[model samples]
Target chain A: MKTLKYITLFAAISTSLLFVQCKDDDDNVITQETCTDGIMNGEETGVDCGGPDCQPCGLVLDFSGTYIQEDQMGRPGINTVFGTEGFKDAFNVTVPSQMQAAFQEKFETKLLGLNPAYTSNALGLDASTFTTVLSNDVLWLAQSGVTTYFNGTEILTGRALSDDVIDVSLLLIFGGPMGDQNPGLTSDGVPTNDAAFSNSFPYLAGPF
Target chain B: MKKSKLFAVIGGIGLAVLSIFLISADHIDAPAVQGTTADITDFYAFQGQNTSNFVFIANVQGLLSPGQPTDEAVFDETVLLEFNIDYNNDLNEDLVIQAIKRGDSMYFFGPTAPAFSGEEGTKSTIATSTRRSVKISTRDDVQIAEQDGMKFFAGPREDPFFFDFNQYNAVLSGTASSFNNPGMDTFAGTNVLSVVVEFPKSMLPGGTTGVNQFAPSTPMYNVWVEAKRKQ
Candidate 1:
C-alpha cells in the first residue's frame, strides 16, 4: 500500500509539471505573434498578414481596383422618365450598346403609357424609332459643328451649358410633328438657370 | 477582452462618421446611387472658348443646399468620376478620362484607353504617362490647371440644370394637365460638384493631324459620364 501511494504521488507531480510547462509555452507564443502591432515585424508579408498567425496578403496594386461605377448618365432624364422603380437600377448599369436591345421595348411601353397620343414627336420619329433612339441613352456630339442642344435648326449636336434641356425634352415629348401640339404641357416655365454661366473655360457658374 | 471592446467602439464611431458624409439624395432616376456620392446629376459637352478645343463637364452630388456647410458637400474621395468617349460610335468607351479627389487635390488619368469598359464597369488604373494633378477649388475663386494645352478644373458650381421638378411630378402623376407659367426652379439654390476638362480636338481618334477638321471620315463622338465607387 505504501509503495502504491508513492507511485501515485510521483505520477501526479509529473502531470502537474507538464501542465506548468505547457502554460509557459502558450505565454511565449502569445508574445511571438503580435499581429495587431502595426509594424511589419515578425513573419508578416504585409503589415500584419501573410504570417502564420494572421491572414495572407494579396499585394494589391495602388489604383489597381481604384473605383467602380455606381451610376452612369448619358443623356439627362432618359432613365428618370422611362424607368420605374425596379427597372431604374438596372437601366443605369446597362451598357449603352446593349441598352436598346435590353430596354427598348420597355421604354416604348412606358413612353406610350405616358403619352397615349404619342403618334410622333418633333423629331418626326414614330413610337418604335423614338424609343429605340432613347433606349441607347448616349449623348451624341458632332466633332465639328455649332454645338447646341436644340436651336430650332440644329438638334442634339452637343449640349451647351445654357441649353434649356428640360424645356426641349418637354417639347419633344408632348409637342406633335409641328412641335406645337400641347403648348401648356411643353416648356417648363423656368427658362434660365438662377445664376448665369461663365463664358470662359469651366463654364459653369461659381457656387454661391 | 478590454482591447477588443475598445476596437469595437472605435469601429462604430468610424462607421458613423462615414455615414454622415455619405447621405446625399439628389438625382431622381438612380435610386441605388441617390443617397450616395455616386449620384450623377448632369453632364454637358460643348465647344470651348478656344474653339479648337472641346469642353466636357460632369456634375455630381446635386441639389446641395446653399445653407449647408461647404465641407459637408465636398466631393467624396471614394467616388471616381469618369468621362467616356466613343469615337467610333460603337456605344463603347474607346477613350476615358478619370478623376478622383485626394487630399484637397483632384488627380486625373487618361485621355488614354480604358483598362476595361462595359456593363461590368471600369477598373480605373492611373495612366502614368498622361496623368495630371490639380488643386481642388474650395472658394469663390475658380481654380484651373493647364498642362500641355489640356485644361482641368474640379470644384463646386451652381446647379445649372433648371427643372420644375414639382410640376413635372404632378404632370407625371396625372394630377396636373400642364406646367405653370414661371414654374418653380427646383434646382435654383442648389450646388453640385463639377469636373471640367478641355483638350484639343486633335487628341481624339482620327484627328491625329493635330488640326481641327470636319473631314467626313472623322467620327462623331458619343460621350457620357459615370460616377463610380471602389468595390
Candidate 2:
C-alpha cells in the first residue's frame, strides 16, 4: 500500500513537470489550458491575465500578510544612544517584554560609559535600576492626569505635543540627585517646537 | 550662572564632545532605515483636546525642508504604521491601532484586539470590524475623518521635534561643554509626515476608568509605535 502511494505521488510530480515543459515550449502561444490554469503565465501581469488571450488585469492592492518591522521608537533616542553600536538594529526589533532581559546589561554599560559619575538620576534611579527601567523602552502614559512628559510635577504621564523630551532625557542622564547636577549637559538649548501646536483635534501644526 | 560653575563648564568644553553614536530625537537613524519611510522620527502619546480621548501620534520621513517638493513627501503605500498598546504591563501588545496608505487615502484599523502581536508584525486582517479612514492630506489644508467617536488624520506637519544637532554633536564630541541657551532647532521649518489618531479611552483594553489591577500604579497601558514594511 505504501509503495502504491509513493508511485502515485511520483506520477503526479511527473505529470506536473510534463505540463510545465509543454508550457515553457509554447512561449508566445497561449494554450487555452494555460490561460484558464489559474496561474500567472504568458505575459500575464497578474494571474493569467494581461496576456494575449486573457483579459487585462487591474491593479489589486493587497494589504494583507505579514510585515517586517523596520523601525520602532518608544522613548526617544533610547535605542539610538544606549544600544551598543552593532546591536541597535536588534534593539529595534526586540519585543518590549524581552527588551529588559536582552539589553539591560548593555544599556547599563552604555549609561555608565556616557556618565561615568555613575550615580542615581533625577528619578532617583541608581545606575543598574535606571538602565533596567530604560531597557524596556515603551512610552508609559496614564489615562488620567495632566498628560505631559517628565514635567517636574508629573513623570511619564503621556507626552504632550509640546513636551521637551530631549531636555528631560538629558536631565535624567546628566542630572543627579535633586535633578540639578550638570546644569550644562542637562538641557539642550532648543526648548520647544518651531511652530505652535493647535488646540483642536489633529493638533500638530500645519506644514510650513 | 556662578563664576566657578561657568568656569567649570568652559573648562569641560575640550572634554565634552565624545564620539557617541548620537542621533537626534529618533531622526537620522542607522543605515538600514535612515532614509526609508519606515524610519520612525518620533512617537508622541498624549491626551487629546477633549481630555476624555487619548491621542497617539507617530511622525516619519523626518527633516523635510520647506524647499523640498511637498507632494513628493508622501507616505509610502507599502509601509504600515502600528501603534502597540500593552495594557497588562506584561510588555506584550494586547491591542494595536494600525494605519497604512493606499492610493490617495489612508486607512486605519483597530483600537481593537490584534490578530497578531509582538515583534512578528501584523496583516490587514487585523483591522477586524473597527475601521476608519481619511484622504491623505497633501497640502496645508487638513483632511480629517471622524467615525464612531474616533478621529484620524494623516498629513504633512511641522516637525515637532526640537533638537540642536550641531551643538549636540559638539557636546558629544568633547568640543563644547554644554548646549547653548538658545540652540538652533535643526528641525525648524522642516516637516514630517505624521499619522494622528484620537480615540476615547473606553476603546482601550481597560475601558474608560483605565484602572488595570495588573498595573495599578502606572499608566494602564504601555504604548510604542513601529513602522513595518510589507514583506
Candidate 3:
C-alpha cells in the first residue's frame, strides 16, 4: 500500500510538470514593427511614419512626425481649373512623368469647352499645344535670364513674386489674337499681392 | 466670403502605388487634406536677391486666420517638400531638393541624385546637408539661415494666390461669359506655412550635361514642387 501511494504521488507530480512544460499555443505575443519596416501594416498611413508605433500622419516628416501628403501645387491654378472636379486627389498625387499622358485629353476638351471660339490664343499656341504644356503640370523657370510667368515675349518662363500670374493666365486662356479678346474675362485685376513682397532673401510678405 | 460657393471639388486617385510623392496647387480640391496641414497653396521659383542664386518657395497649410499658433497652424511632418528640377525638358526630375520640418528646425536632404524617381518614388531618406532651426515668427520677426551657398527660411506668410472664383464659376456654369475686372479677392485674409530656400545656380546640374554646367543655350528649366510622404 505504501509503495502504491508513493507511485501515485510521483505520477501526479509528473503530470503537473508535463502540464507546465506544454507549448503555449494560446499565448500570443505580437512582435511590433519598428518604424523602418517599409510596411504600412502598422498604424501608419505610410510605411513606418504614422500610427501608435511612430508619429502621427498629420505632422511633418522632417521632425519625425507622421504626415501623409495632403496637397501639392506646381504651377498655380492649373490643377484648380484644368483638372476635373473629381481629379484633385489623382492630380495632387501624380508624378509629373505620368501627368501629361493621363490628363492631356481631358485638359484639351476642357480648354475648348471653356473657350468655344478657340483658335489660337495670344501665345499663338493652338488648343492642343497649349493643353500639352498645361498637362505636364510644371512651372518652367528661365533660370539665368528674365523670369516672368509671361512678359509678352516669353511665355511660361517662370513666376516672379509680384507677377500678376492670374491675370497673365486669364489672358493666355481667353485673350485672342489682339491679346485682348474678352474685355472682362482677361484680368482678375487683383493685380498685386495685398502686401509688398520683401526685397530680401525669402521674398514673401509677412503673415497677418 | 461665400463659404458655400467655395469649389466643392474632391480629387480621385487612379493609382494607389506603394511609393510616395505629392505636388500641385489644387486648392480646396482634395477631400483628404484641403485647408489642413497637408494643403499646398502655392509654389514660386524666381531669381534670388543675390541674382546668382535661384529661390524656390513652397507654401502649404493655407487659409489660417492671423495670430494662429504653430501648434494649431503649422506644417505637417509626414509631407516632404521637394523641389524637382528637369533641366533637359524631358520632365523627369534630374535633381531633387527635399525639406522637412522637425520641432522648430527644418532639414533639407538633397539636390543630389534621387535614389528612385517618378510617380512611384522610393522613399529614400538622405542625411541632411543643411538644417535651419531658426526661431519661427509670425508677423514682424523674420528668421533666416545660410549653409554651403544655400539660404533657408521657413515660417508663416501672406496668401499670395489671388483669384475671383465666383466669376470663374459663373463662366463655368454658363451663368456669365467672362470674369468681372477687379471682381473679388477670394483668398484675401488667409495665411500659409512657407518654406523658402535659395541655392547657388551652380548646384543645379546642366540639363544637357550634368551638375554645374551652365549651358548658355539651354534656355529653359522646368521646376515643380512635390509634397511626399514616406511609404
Candidate 4:
C-alpha cells in the first residue's frame, strides 16, 4: 500500500509537471504568434477584426464639387451660352487673320516658357480662326467673340483642347505667369501654379 | 491515482485551449481588403456643351496597372450606382438614376424624374438601354438611356485621373525631400472603373435658365457621389 501510495504521488507530481510544461508552451506559442498585440509600436499589423481596434476599409466622402451658375428663366447669364439651343449650329466665323498673328505671337512669347516648342502648327486652327474657334468651342475661357457652339458635337470637337488645360496649367499655372514664385515642380514634375490660378475662371474639375 | 487523473485532465484542458487560441491568431494575421465597400476616387458632374445634357462621371478601381487585368474583373454585380438630384432648397435626394452591371454589360434603372420631387425608387422610368459587350472601347447607353429626358452611357473606359502616387507617398512618408521639377505621376499609367451619365439641364432642380434663381443657390453646387453595396 505504501508502495502504491508512492507510485500515485509520483504520477501526480509528473502529471502536474506536464500540465505546467504544457501551460508554458501554450503561453510561449501565443506570445510568438500575437507577440505585439499584432501592432508595431502602435501601428496596426493585423487584419481588421470588425472591432474597435480593427479599421475596416470604407468609402471616404469626397466633397469636391464645384458649383457654376446654370441658365435660368428668359434672362440667362452670358456664362449660360452652352445651355442655349441653336448655340452650336449657328454660323461659325473664322478668326481674323491679323488677330491670329497677334494672338499667336503673344501666346508664343508669353506662354512658350510654359509649353516648350509651343508652335501654332500643332494648333488645329490657323491664327485668324483660332480665337473664334476657342471663344465658341471652349467652355472655360471667357467668351470674347461670337459664341455659337451649344451643341455637344462642337464642344466634343474641342474636348482635347479643353482637357489639354491639364498640361497647359501645369506649365503656365506655375512657372509662366500664374505659377508660384517658389521654383519647384509639383510631385508630378508639373510646376506648381499659383493658388490663384487654381481659383481662376472655369475651375477645371479634377481627380486628375 | 485520483490525483494523477485530475492532473491529466487539467493538462488536456490546457492543451485544448491553447490550440483554439493559436487557430484564431492565424486567421487574424491574413491581410486582405474586405468586400461590400466602394472606394470612389473621383466624381464629376458638369453640363455638356456638345449636348443640352449634363454629364456625371464616377471613377473607381483607382491606381490600377495595365497588367492587372484580373483585379479589373471583380466589380460587384449587385452593387448599385445611384445619381441623386435635389431640386428644392432642402438637402435631400429628389431624383435617382441607378445602374447595375452584369456579365460584360451594364443596365441603367431610372432617370426616375417625377412631376414633383420625391424618392427615386418610387419614380417612373423614363427610358431604358443596354450597352454592348465589355471591351476597351467607347460604348453608349446601358439603361434608361433617357431619364427625365436625358442621355446616358455606362461601360468600361481608361481612367482619366493622373496622379503621382509614388512621389505623393514619398512626400507623406518623409522619404522624399521635395517634388520633382515637372513632377512625377505615379498614376500616369494606371486605369480605373468609370460610369458616365448625362442629363438635361431642365431636369435638375435649378431651372433651365442661366441665373442664380435655383435652389441650393451657390455659384458652385455642392455635390458628392457614392456606390452603395447591395445587401
Candidate 5:
C-alpha cells in the first residue's frame, strides 16, 4: 500500500511539471504583434531602409522619344462641316473585307461611298440651298485628309476615329474663318493646344 | 523494471525540447548586412564624344521628394556598387567597374575582377594594373549643354514612366465602367534612382561593326543593368 501511494505521487508530479514547461514554452513563441513593427532585429528597422513611412520606390524602364509640334499661333483648323459622305472620304477607311461583305449583305445596297448630303442633314446643318464657297472648301478639306504611320504601323490611316486628326482637320478649315464667319472670334473655341504629344516625342515637328 | 522505463521516457522528452530551442536560436541571429538590401532602380552605359572614353551610371536612393535631396540621407557607406562586364562570351563578369560615394562626392574604384562573390567584408583590391579611378562630376547630365565624353552621375531623378494607376485600381475594384480610350497615365510625375555611364564604343570588343549583332555580343555589346541586394 505505501509503494502504491508513492508511485501515484511520482506520476502526478511528473505530469504537472511537463504541463507547466509546455505552457511556458508555447507562451514564448513570437507572434506578428509581438515583433517590433515587422522588424525582426534592432539592426534592421523596416522592410525598406527609411521605414514604412518612406515614399514608394520609383523605376523607369523605357524612356525615349520626342514631340514634334509646338506652334500655338499657327495651329491648324478642324473641318467639322463634313456630312456622312465627307466623314467617309476624309477618313479613307477601307472597311475590313469581312465587315464590308457583312454590311453589304445586311443593307442589300452596294454601299460604295457614304453620302455627305445625308450626313449634313443628320447633323442639322443649314442645308437649305446654302452654297457658300467656304462651305465647299471645308468639304474639300474633309475629303482629303492625311494619314500618319508610326514605326511602319498605320496608327492613323487617313482620318478615321482620330480625335486629334479630326480636331486638326476642323481647325485647318475653321481656324481661318473664325474671325470672318463669327466676328470677335480669335480661334476655334476648343482648347486643342496641350503638351501631351510634345513631351513624349520631342523630335517630331507638329501634331498637324 | 517499469519504473526504470518511465524514467527513460521522461529523459527522452526533455532532450527533444531542448534540441528544438537550440535550432531556432541560430535562425534568429542572421547577420544584418545580408538582411537589409533593396532592388536597384537604374543602370546606364553610354559613350562620351571627342574622347576615347566611356561613362557608367548606377543610381540608388529612389523616389525621394525634392525636399529630401540634401538630407544626410545618402548611400550606406558600406554598400558596394559593382558594374559587371562580360568581356568574354560567358555570362559571368570578366571585368567590373565599381563606385562608392563619400561625403557628397562619388569615387570610382575599378574595372577589376571580383575577389569574392556573395560574401561580406571587402576583399583585397585586385592588382593595381587593372584598376582605374575617377571622381564624380557635379553637373547634371540632363541639363548639360554638351558632354564631350567624360561624365558620370548616379542619383535620384523624376520618374519618366507613364501609367494610369488610379484607373487601373478602379478597374480592379469593379467600380470603373471602362478604361479610357487612350487610358490614363498614373506615373506621369514621379522620380527614380538613375545610374548613367558612358564609354567609347571602341573600348568594347566589337566597335559598332554592324547595326545589330546576334550573340550576347562580347565583341559587339548591348548592356542592361541590375542591382542585387544581399539575400
Candidate 6:
C-alpha cells in the first residue's frame, strides 16, 4: 500500500509539473490564430495587420499620397467602347449617380459612330435610354428571377458565370431586332471558360 | 468567439486605402493601372443556389498564365475591394460589401448599412462591428467559410470569361463586318484572383422593385466593384 501510494503521488507530481511548464505556451493556444481581437498579439506588426492572420505591410501597393482612379468594369464595354481617352478618367472617376448627365451625349455619339444605323435595340431601348443604362455603369440584378446578363426574356438581371455577356452586348449594339443584321460582327467567337467552375459556394473554376 | 459573430474586413485600396470599382470589361486596357492589382478584369453578380441568396464576384489581374511561375500574385494589401449596390435606382450604393486580405485570410464587412458613400470612398477606420473571415485557399487546396448566414471564399480561381480578342480587334479595325462562328478562345488556359461572397438577399435594402424592363420607378439594383488605395 505504501509503495502504491508513493507511485500515485509521483505521477500526480509529474503531471502538475508538465502543466506548469506549458502554462506560458497555453496563453497563445487560444489566441494565436485569431486576427481581429483588436489586440496585436502573435507576430502581427500592427493592430490586426501583418503576420500570418492578416496581409503583411510589404505586399500592399504603395498608394500613400494620391488615390488616383485605377480601373473600372460594370458592363463589358462601357468604358472601353464608349468613354473616350480624354473622358476615360472623367468617366471612371464620375460617380454612377452623376454618370449619365456627364456622359450620355458622349455615349450616344460613340454609339452612332460605331453602328451608324442608330436605331432602337432588340430590347426597344433607344440610344438615349440605352446609353442612360450603360452610363450608370452597374450590373443590375433581380432578386427572385433567373440570373443572366440578358436572356431575351430578362435584360440586365444580374450575370451568371457562364452567361455570354459579350455576345448579348454585341447583339444589342450591332445586331438589329431579329439579331441578324450584323451576324458577322456580333460574336467574338470564344465561348465558355477555359475550365469548369465549382457548383458550390465561390462557384469559380479551379486555376489551371 | 467574438470574431466568428462580428468582424469586418475593410478591403483597403488606393495609396493608403484601396478601392476597386468594376465599370467596364477589358483584358488589358487602362494604360495607367494595367497589369496591377487595381486591374479589375471582370465583375459578376448572380442569384445564389437558394433564390433568396445573392453572390458577388470580382476578378482581378487577368491573363495570369496558367502554367507560369513568374506570375504568382496576391490581393494588394494597400487596396480595398468594395462592391457598391444601388437598390433604389439612384445609381449610388446604399450598401457596400468590403473585402480585405490579410495573411492567408480574407475578411468581409457590411452588406450592412453604408457608413460612407460616393466616388472616392474613404474606408471607415472603424473595425467592422461584425467580422467574418475565411482561410485563403491555395492552388492545391480550396478554402471556404460560413458564418452569420453568409458564405465567403477567396484565392486563385480559373478565369471563366470567354472572348476572342484577335477576332474582336479584327472587326473593330474594319477588316471584317462581324465575327467568325467559332473564334479562338484567348482567355483559355489562364487564371485570375477571385474574391467571392454569398449572402441573404434581404441583407440588401430593397422594397419597390422593377416589374419589367420597361417599368419606371422600379428599383433597379446597380452593382459595381472598385479597387481604391488609402489616401
TM-score for each candidate, following the candidate numbering: 0.76, 0.79, 0.74, 0.40, 0.35, 0.77
Q: What's candidate 3's DockQ score?
A: 0.23
How many clashes in each structure?
Answer: 0, 7, 22, 38, 42, 56
Summing lDDT over every window of 10 consecutive residues in candidate 1 chain A, give the lowest-scoring window.
A22-31
Cα-based lDDT at residue A169, candidate 4: 29
What value does DockQ give for candidate 4? 0.04
Fnat by candidate, in order? 0.68, 0.68, 0.57, 0.08, 0.00, 0.59
**Candidate 1 or 2, higher lDDT?**
2
Tens digit of per-residue lDDT, candidate 3, span A1-208: 4345445655666666685865533112224655554444546666556665555556553344333343556687787667653676777777777888888888887676556666787767889988887888888776576676766665565787777787877787767756767666678667766677888878877777
Better of 4 and 5 by DockQ: 4
Query: What are the per-residue Cα lDDT tens digits for candidate 2 across A1-208?
Result: 4345445656666677775744333322334434356656556666755665444577354577667787888888897678644677778777887889899999987776666675887777898988887898888778676777767777777778788888988888778767787688788888888899999878988887
lDDT measured at residue A173 in model 1 versus the true structure, 0 to 100: 73
Best by DockQ: 2
Question: What is the per-residue lDDT of model 3 for residues B1-231, given as tens digits with 9 covering 90 to 100?
Answer: 111221111011112210111222356656665656666778898878787889998888776677745325766566678787888877777788888767656667667766556654424454354333344554666778676788888888877767666565555444564567667766666778889989988888654423112233536677887776755
**Candidate 4 lDDT score at position A86:** 22
DockQ of every predicted complex = 0.24, 0.31, 0.23, 0.04, 0.01, 0.28
Better of 2 and 4 by DockQ: 2
Candidate 4 Cα outliers beyond 4 Å, as residue runs: A1-208, B1-37, B49-51, B67-74, B113-149, B207-221
i-RMS, each model, one decimal: 10.9, 3.8, 6.2, 22.0, 26.2, 10.3
Report the C-alpha lDDT of model 1 over A97-200, residue by residue, as the tens digit. 88999999998886665555678888788889888877888776777767777877677777898888888877877677788776876888988888998889
Rank by TM-score (best first):
2, 6, 1, 3, 4, 5
Highest TM-score: give the candidate number: 2
TM-score of chain B of 1: 0.79
Between candidates 4 and 5, name the one with more favorable TM-score: 4
lDDT of 5: 0.29
TM-score, candidate 2, chain B alone: 0.83
